[model samples]
Target: MLGLSAFLESGRGDKLSSPVKQFIQNLLKANMEGPYGSEWPAEEKVKRREMVAPEARYVFVRIASLGEFLTTSEREKTAASCVEERGPIVGFVHFRFVIEEELPVLYVYELQLEPRVQGKGLGKFLMQLIELIACKNHMGAVVLTVQKANSAAMNFYLYKMRYVTSTISPSRVDPLIGIEKSYEILCKTFSNEAKAILEEPLELVHSV
Candidate 1:
């Protein structure tokens, strides 16, 4: 069942509620520890907390009785009390609309699903919904960063979703220079303006 209608949107003003933060932390630990633990354990902990901070917007998947999804907006709401008795949250997507390199974009910070829900097309469904949101808001593109060690995510974004490596991605800018970073930037452009801006050579754009 699970259609696009079963998602709720919430905005965290200056801090994440305890319950929401805990949910994110648990998901992050389950999803990222394997890829990031060996190299920078402490850093991963810091990053996980930072990712779910006040500034991020969230979309939570809710299951309905009839097997269809429901969509709700809590833009004016605050605190975890709103979610106290909303049943189990199957998964969530954290993102923000921001301007990157002067180009407007929808940047996805995290897309974590319960282990039992993985590989059921829910991830792809959520991403498609995000793209729709971006387009409606006039964002030129959608972008996200993936850890190099997370092969599954990399494959999902690149091969399955057809996202391309951003021209500004460290590796794309300069392979040798980018080796120091452990992540790759990926993007999907929606307009010619976005393509021109994001696909331009970084060196050329920087010089201009």
Candidate 2:
């Protein structure tokens, strides 16, 4: 991995260049195509539209190569510049701040890393950072959707990150309906109200 120098930046989806959009589409296909199988073609049609929605924000992770001869100051500048223009992009997180069950939350639409970086704690670092942002911004919780077919991802969020399945998730609201669905909604709550509404296994009922 050449001791990856990963730098991140946040911006709206519309601001992404064509190359970066292609990178995201390719990465998503590589990671999810197998899990989605026959449904992949249809799913990708929807993703293409969602990935560029004006309201969505993104965090891009780009890799910068460092030369040993470069001074510390030079390396830092090179990295920051490469992140904006020349570096290879390795991963991204697409998110939005929205109302979930009447409480404001940061909804993670996608969090993807190249296969080479999968087991290196980068995913955890990103989620922790996202959760911190949500807390700092006074959001109630951090929410995300995970595919049931991707058991590795489900386990990662549930056990490693300690995110509970939200009450609004289909399974928690109604098992019959949830059984036919392919994904689960997960959340990490920050307040008593959020905890009760999102963490508990309750049906889909709005609070007064």
Candidate 3:
């Protein structure tokens, strides 16, 4: 289990361990820094908090351990359905949010798939599910950061659901590795649709 140690290890519990945290830390750093420079301690800590808050309603996908899965985290369980094929847990999606603008900005915090189930359209399905949750929550919009280099994922965010691009600053700790290293932000809005729907509601109801 050379590469699978983190995924296979027991006692993962609710929060990510230091090593797991470090792995995510470095992964995000590389993604942000373009395999070039390093991040400072303060910057690293801020990144870690943003990614793996223990209180955040994180999601995990697994193939086994159905009975006791919900008890393994600090956050409250929202949706915990299984994806079965021929009958077993093949994948799952976890979602949560941080408050923004007095509304919950839905975050598709974690998505995972077993190697055996990777190629199917499950990812797209899960994303749509998250989007519906965002709509239901009446969020100002949904936000998630993706590496600029990941074209496949960027396409999914951009074309599939119509996420618009924006940018954020590069803190001193993790200086922008290059132009592409700027944080990529995406959002969706409902104000236009809301105005249209609200205006027609009384007229439509009366006509009906």
Q: Which one is best on lDDT?
A: 2
lDDT (10s digit) by residue, model 3, range 1-208: 1111111122222465554444445444544444223434556567556566554554333333333323455112212222223223334444566664444567554454543344455566667767777788786556676555666667877897677652221221234543546346555655654323222233553586
- Backbone clash count for every predicted candidate, in the order shown: 5, 0, 1
Task: Please write out the lDDT profile of model 2 over residues 24-131, one tens digit for every residue.
Answer: 898899999988888999999998898999988888777665435457886665444325565767788999899988999999999998775567677988999999
Report every candidate's CA lDDT.
0.75, 0.83, 0.48
Distance from true location, Cα of 184 in model 3, Å: 0.8
Superior by TM-score: candidate 2 or candidate 3: 2
Once fitted onto the true fold, the runs of candidate 1 whose alpha carbons sit more than 4 angstroms away are: 1-7, 13-15, 64-84, 201-208
Query: Model 2's lDDT to the true fold?
Result: 0.83
In model 2, pairs of residues that clash are none
Off by over 4 Å in 2: 65-85, 201-208
The parts of candidate 3 lying over 4 Å away from their true place are 1-54, 62-94, 101-103, 167-182, 193-208
TM-scores for every predicted model: 0.79, 0.84, 0.49
Local lDDT at 30 for model 1: 74
